[model samples]
Target: MRILVLANFGMGLYNFRKELLKELIKNNHEVFISLPKDEYKPKLEEIGCEFIDTPVSRRGTNPITDFKLFMNYKKIIKEIKPDIVLTYTIKPNVYGGLACRVTKTPCIVNITGLGTAVENGGVLQRITLYLYRISLKKVNCVFFQNEENKKTLIKSKAIVGKNMVLPGSGVNLEHYNLMEYPKPQVVNFLFISRIMKEKGIDQYLEAASYLKQKYSNVNFHIVGFCESEYKNKLTNMQDKGVIEYHGKQSDVKRFYEISHCTVHPSYYPEGMSNVLLESAACGRPIITTNRSGCGEVVDEGVNGYKVKPENSNDLIEKMEKFLNLSYETKVKMGLSGRRKVEIQFNRRTVIDTYLAEIHNITER
Candidate 1:
């Protein structure tokens, strides 16, 4: 079987679904990946994937550009003639699914995140919901990362095919092995995510600022790409020594190794947060928003604690609890997180699910 994977960004495929693609290759399936060419292209190529440079503009919401993207997907699907098409991200899932439908190709879409457009609930959300309803009407399978996201889709009448919930792309337990919790003199709290407003970055910053005044020994670190608009603010905060901001790190495991807890105060609708998953896999306790996908990862003070979405005070309270806890208790919390990942969010489970779905689509 020949499988064509479509996504908005190339690196995302390499980072998250590389194992699944490798599994496909091991099973003797020809794999083709279509995404905007970037540094990760070489990595995917090295893994025996035929790469097609796709023109996918992540920030382009213009009608003409989107129509062109649709046409491009149609051209690629027609040329590749794949046995099954798997898509991720917003534009690819919507436009690519439409192309798959038009080309009479079996398609599966992974609802990674609903995004701010849907979360904000406006004209764009209405338009997106309508587009999704039409585009996914004929898709063979729709993979949702969590039940809340699935319910949102069903409530919006977007999916017309079989829907399956996955464990948020699932974490590679071997790659992110559980390690002994670090026992640094000062407590370290790390936030790993793209610096976006919807991701509750503002809340994290506010919490860090307030906590810093009281707890001089505690350190706050952020590791991810800061959006252009938020760069200056983050730089200013870094200059003031309020937080240490390492812009876009490829090797996040090193930072996780030193960190005591992972904070992902995200209000953005996510399928499941990869940051929290990796942190847990690395045996770090998490403090995230009490919302779908993000909230589901926590067992409420078992593995970690869930704070109210966009509430800096609530986040401060949780972080304070971590600071006040004994080192041994925190280590136990970290171990609990590792256990949760092994039981529910292992990457092997995700790979097996994809393989089964692909076989079902092709064999049928």
Candidate 2:
């Protein structure tokens, strides 16, 4: 079977889906990737996969450009004649699915998250949702990362009732294995995400500031790139000594190993948070917002805590819980998190499910 995976960015697919790609190759399936040209090109080739460069505008919505993208994608699909196409993210899922439909090729769309456009809701949101409803009608299957997204799709009639709900791209347990629970020397809290205001960065900073004033022993560490728009806010927070920003990191496991807990206060409608899953896989407790995708991962008092999104008081309270817990209690919470991932978010399970779905769609 020949499969084409379409996405906006190269690194995300290359890194997160490597295991799945390897499995497909091992099974004698031909897998091709379609993404923007990036540093991962050599790596993708080395993995025995063919790469196709496609230009994509990830941040904006322009009808003329989007039409051109759709036409380009249509041409590519016609030329490749892939048995099936798998797409992720908003632009690919909408425009790519339409292109596949034009070529009469079966396509599966994985809604990774309801991006700012749809979540924010207005004229753009209405238009995008209408496009989704139209495009999805032709898709073989739609995969959602969390229940909230699935519910929203169903409510909006964008997808049918039988669509699959997958837990976010499963965490790589091998790479994020349970580390020996670290003793909290300073009650270090880590937030790993793109430093966007939508990700509740301000809330995190506010919580960090409030905590630091009360408990001098507490420390906040942030890991990820700051978009230009939000750079000033991040800079302001850092200047105020609210948090230590460790710019984009290729290796996040080290930070997870040293930190006592992970905090993701994002109000953005997420799919499933890979950071939270990775933290849990590393045997570290998590404190995240009680919003859609974020809320689905935690078991409250058992493995982690869920605080209200954008509520600095709630976030600070949860952080204080971790700070106040006995070393033994913290260790137990971390163990519980590891157990949760083992039973639910294992990468193998996600890969297997995806493969089975692909086979089912292609066979039909």
Top lDDT model = 1
Give the worst 10-residue stretch by lDDT in candidate 2: 159-168
Best by TM-score: 1
Model 1: number of backbone collisions: 0
Q: What is candidate 1's lDDT per residue for 89-187, written digit by digit as tens?
A: 999999999999999999999999888788789899999899999999999999999898788889999986799999999999999999878876899
Candidate models: Cα lDDT each:
0.91, 0.87
lDDT of 2 by residue, 1-364 (tens): 8888889997788767889888888889888888889988888878878999989999878889899889988988888889999899999999998898788899889999988888889998899889988878888889889988888888889886348888789889899988998766788899999988878888888888888899988889999988898777777878988788889987788999789999999998888889998999999989998888788779999888999888888888888887998988889999999999889888898899888888887776
How much is the lDDT of residue 337 in candidate 2? Answer: 92
Error of 2 at 250 (Å): 1.5
lDDT of 2 at 363: 72
Q: Using Cα atoms with residue i matched to residue i, what is each candidate's TM-score against the true structure?
A: 0.98, 0.96
- Give the TM-score comparing model 2 with the true structure, all chains together: 0.96
Lowest summed-lDDT stretch of 10 residues in model 1? 179-188
